[model samples]
Target: MKRCKRVAVVLPVAAGLCLVYAPVAVADADASIVSAEVSGTLTPGARASVKVVVMNHKAPAGQKSCISAKMDGGGGTSCFDLGAPGTSVTHDGFMEVLKDAKPGPRTVTVNLLPRAVGGLGKDTKTVTATVGNAPPACDPVSLNRDAFQLGHTEGLKDGREDGFADSYRQSYDDAFKKKPGLTAEQCQDFALSAFQNGYGKGYETGFKEGQAKGGKVGEKEGKEDRQKGNTSRNVTIRQLRVTALPATGEADCAQGVKFTASFLGSGTGTIQFHWERSSGKVPGTIEFSGGDAEPKTVTDQAAVPAGATTATLTQKFVIDSGPSKGKTAQATANVTCKK
Candidate 1:
């Protein structure tokens, strides 16, 4: 009868069973240029000291962050490693100004490349440096050739993207309306048509843009070169036009109305102008440094009264002083406040 009393013993199970954990990976975040500065006389064939401050925005701890600075036109690039999130690093480097570099302001671009995670970001800042004397007489042949090439490259890129988008949208819409689901052959055909259309449009756009750009460059350079030594030339307003947004439709009262004034001028002097509005007037001026008749635009906004349900806005661009004084162009917009 005593054998009925039995005891059970329990052993530790944690030691017998092993638990394993995989390490978690952290993704890198974009870094940004907080501030950038370039100093020293940037003369031809000289080096200018550059200082850049970079900050990591949201990268987790232990993530690798880097930023590189490259001059816009041409120069060696400098890169630096950054610290954790909310941390900033300062990098000091030198940028060389090419002997043939153009005078005036130049741009320096900063690129952020996260190492741990694949991501890219960039920012640009400008530093004005006098690389050389006022641009020497631009050679017509050389200017035209360079401008043509630049225009063609830019136009081709833009046109190809636009054409592809248009073709793809049309093809997708057409295929979607078919009786059955889109087939693989239809998809192939869509892609082929898109690419062919893109190529054709790109070539046509590139040629036209190249010719137009070349003409404009040639005309501007020719005029500037011709009037370089003539400081006594008086500015003359050659053309003036004004346009208003929502010219005859309803618009938000708070959002206001916009007016644009475009004018073309010739000669080297200052042109005094003013915007005459239904409510008030604003005085403005434009300085023409070269003799070329370049087109310039000025924009103005008209605000509606807080309680006004409907209003008529009128704006006039007037030439106050110059040979073309008294010349005026005006536009009117009728707006109704949105409910």
Candidate 2:
């Protein structure tokens, strides 16, 4: 059994309206499987673990329903009631069958029963487990909480052992006292330090290892696939925001024009400012300055190339791309998502 190491699963969307529909699909799709994955190699008599998670798949939104294991190799089968609702579920290896000699290709069918009813939906996914193989040396990783990023290990615990309980206050103090804005990397660093200092130091190892893996931050670089050619994964945005400062243009060619996306989203993502020609003469060399850590303006505004009607601008988040396909994204572009 070739165990697929993929963690997240991309589910089916409706006929159209990709943006507003993902959460809906995850919540309402009765027979569809969002993500069902497995980790670990089973040796004859060795214990392996399986994990699963769903997005708003059941009542209370965050809780996962139930899961069971069925052995396809010579090994026997068992099920874990989970005993309660959770957004994620995990179970250790088959204790009874670990001593058996069931080797070679096998399958561990992970059935996610959301509510003891139609919760598992009509279509559920199954991942394979290699009965005999050289197991990975590193400890398993995780991608818990609200989001799942790519080109990065899914579940790398920071140094903090007690979750957010002991470290948030210290982290907030450091971030506020030292800088005006915090990047993801910096936040992770702060989190790592807090987790490490409060906890032992083991939790710090996973993250460094995960980051040592050089990868960009984004959806296209990891386990989940991006809905290509579709707006679900790719997009072009135009943000028109009302600023606190007056809209009066300055006479100085250098400081006259203005741009702001770089100033928003807490610097977590890039913001491109294009002078909507429809509004006014797209000012030449529009300069940008923001209340971010790197508080310097792009004074040497790049010249707009010939044949360009609206200025071409780009801003990117310092995130890793995919181990899967494109990922689901939410943005504030001044346009409607197509179905």
Candidate 3:
């Protein structure tokens, strides 16, 4: 033991031991829906395809993720798996517009779930799809034809009334001159003119109505009707009378005198006439349309002869054509001359 102790115990001092600790790196697990789109026309009772894209910000190793979509009204939920970190995945599906669906924009919502034990909360995205109007169902050709026939019938009625007024006016004029009224040929021309005018107006109105009821076909038929301008029949007229306003007395020399002629009639057509004054004749014309039973008037002025203290003037209204043709109505006025 003494010898061993003296041998200078060479048991090497155990080398000082050092321990180091390091932090473990954990991966981030976050996923989100990037976008969603719906393609194809979305008419009622029609189907359209849907597309959704999802992106993951970071993914834990071996983690699973999924994206899903649901439409606002009725399409069921659809899902697809997501890719790795910093990558995007696309999901495709289809949706249908209900037969009774209202026209306008509809929405689809998409959601993303990381599926990892501890990942970011669910991410959501929305897309819009438009629903269009349904196609028309009526027979367009039949609608257009009905419109034309309606217009023609109404036009004939209007044309007859107008034609009658025209012929009646001519008959009155001829009768006033003790001559025969409108010839067959002349009467036919008048009827044709009236028919064309009435038909054109009625056709336009009916065509527009038809277009509202029949769509494109109605428009095409309307154009054809306008180009036709077909002709038809004619008719007659009734009474006429003229009266003078202020038929008794008046005054003012420098300012002259004013006279008015009023005519009342129950028919249509143009009338030719003249004013016969103590001075001269003034020619004129007046027209009537429809079954106007109202009075129409015209005016004229006369000057007092110079140097005359008291002046008496006479004015006459004469019809040159129509049932009252050649008939005359007269009036007198007394004026005080101013120097």
Candidate models: Cα lDDT each: 0.55, 0.32, 0.51
Question: Per-candidate TM vs. native?
Answer: 0.32, 0.25, 0.30
Best by TM-score: 1
Ranking of all predicted structures according to lDDT, beginning with the best and ending with the worst: 1, 3, 2
Q: Taking the tens digit of each residue's C-alpha lDDT, what string does model 1 give over 218-336?
A: 34433443456422223556558999887754577898889999987766666778999767789988888765577889999888878997888889999875345566899988766
> Residue 259 of model 1: what lDDT?
93
Backbone clashes, each candidate:
0, 44, 6
Residues 1-339 of candidate 3 have per-residue lDDT tens digits of 000000110112223212121221222336655666666446565565666655656754335655454655446355555555665655665666677877766666655555557655267666666666754443434433544454466754434434433444343333333422344344444444444544566544554453243333323333333345311111122333334333333345766667777666555556677999766799997777646464677777877787777677777887765434455666677554433
**Comparison by lDDT, 2 against 3, better one:** 3
lDDT tens digits, residue span 73-155, model 2: 33333443322222222333232335454566555555545544544432334566566642222211331221233212223
RMSD of each: 30.0, 21.5, 41.3
Residue runs of model 3 more than 4 Å from their true location after superposition: 1-250
Question: How many angstroms is residue 240 displaced in model 2 relative to the true structure, after the best TM-score fit?
Answer: 52
Which portions of model 2 miss their true places by more than 4 Å?
Answer: 1-32, 57-59, 62-64, 73-97, 115-123, 133-339
Worst ten-residue run, lDDT, model 3? 1-10
